[model samples]
Target: MSFYFNIATDKTVTADQILEALGRPEVSVDDNKMIFHIPGKSLRGACVYHSDEGYEVGVNAFTPKTDARLTRDVAAAIAWLTGASVVPEDSEDSFSPEYIADYGGEDWVAERFDEAYFLARRPDDAAEGGPLSVAGYKRTFAVTPDMFEQDAGSLEDAIRAVMQVGIDLQTLDDREDIFAASLMSFTPPAAPPQSTLRRMFGLSKPVSNVREPYTAFFIGPDVRTLTPYNETSDPFYVHLSVDQKAVFRLPADDFFAYAEAAGARAYGAQVYDITISQADHAKLMQQAEPA
Candidate 1:
């Protein structure tokens, strides 16, 4: 792994000054971020940190300059060297009200996180038969700050971009059978304002024919609940199969609590915030596979 030093200054500061301050004179500069070589993993985002006022530093698993590697360390180094604090940056303010509002609020921003995080919580196919047939799919979009702003600042559009990007990549890989062979990274570019998401893969519309116990989740204002019959079930669970030997049978509330905890454990991960219905629960349990 490589090491780096970064300094964020409200007032301009030179790269040489930063290295001198850190007592490491042999540092190299890259783009806005800088780098240095340490014996092993050192000064990574997870291990090295500076306050909002000071510089942040870290070591990354990837080549800090390339998408091939990203880690807590790289995040730190970037924040420090570029003088760009991580979005929702502070640990103390990790799950704060502002934090939740920016990411977990109603609209598209919240939805993407909801799918990556909250949605992933619903039980997976932890059964004996193939992956316990959870029959629903997630929509991902490739979004940017500008695109989000243009959609009347609706986060839903951003979410759509991610879904679109994911779909496109999925299709390319499926059709070419080359997705698995490349040592490339699929970092979706930041969505542009008034941007159009090109569909990559998956059904353009919901696949009604493959009906299964399913649930849907979204980030929106007003705690919208999902009823079994409601056309728009926020988190509607789908039932498709059953597991004879269930490992952990948790109540709905407990299940959600577990999911929340799991989401908190992941850094730089998106979690969706939404409500579900009792009917959705029934569907989720319909094909219950215990791990």
Candidate 2:
């Protein structure tokens, strides 16, 4: 199923203004309505129309295929343009396994189901000195079995519930343990048999033998900050750093290529590209563990 969100604001905005906010050119504009399209991304089309209550900005279709962060970015942009709070539409209930399978791949959705089941079955209170009770208080959390049923709505609700709990348990200063747990559970897809070219290029090495993939969290910069770098004439690559030491330079095209090749997926509120096998992921997790 597709997703949708609405922005209700009292500020006056025009079609051109909306397009400008999205950094897209207006495709068509009537007296009361304007349409814009994003060429290649999940955000396909959007329309801004005048309304009595306020201006309404609606997206064409948003689904698992769409970048999850795009919704929030769009809402923020609309709010900025109209000077009003953008009320996002909640279509989480409408998300189904069938839709996710159709758009995001069956294996991807199945893994989520497995994770939900695992989390649901875990005990609310851990054993003494266990991870959950380290802070000296018993933690209570459980997911109902109904969430794991072979239905779309239940699965969606269960996923959302689990994600919400995970988010709530996270602290700003600490590492995201919930996200690490999810990463540890991932099983990489079986790679194709090495071909002559792959053998020549030594493409069969374990991911650990290659450059270790690191998670770079980008905050403080809005979407607009990337606009100049994204321009076709002067596109720039991403340079990553840790503790002021330059780690690597990621070519713009290679970023998506690695993700697609490795079946890398993003998790949590912040975008994270998990580009390593379960073993490698576990290794990273161990490194990040408190001494």
Q: Count the clashes in each prediction.
A: 41, 0
Per-residue lDDT of 1-291 in model 1, one digit per residue for the tens?
A: 323233344534454554454443433333243433321211221223445554444432211121112223334334444545453332423232223324322352232234432222324342222111111111122222332234354454544443333333322323442212111111223433331333345324332343233332221112232211213223332222223233212233344453365342210112222333445444445434331
Candidate 1 residue runs with Cα over 4 Å from true position: 1-270
The best candidate in terms of TM-score: 2
Residue 256's lDDT in candidate 1 = 44
Question: What lDDT score goes with residue 30 in model 1?
Answer: 36
TM, every model: 0.18, 0.26
TM-score, candidate 1, is 0.18
Residue ranges of candidate 2 with Cα displaced over 4 Å: 24-33, 40-44, 60-72, 91-291
Candidate 2 lDDT, 135-156, residue by residue in tens: 1011122233333345456655
Candidate 2 yields a Cα-based lDDT of: 0.37
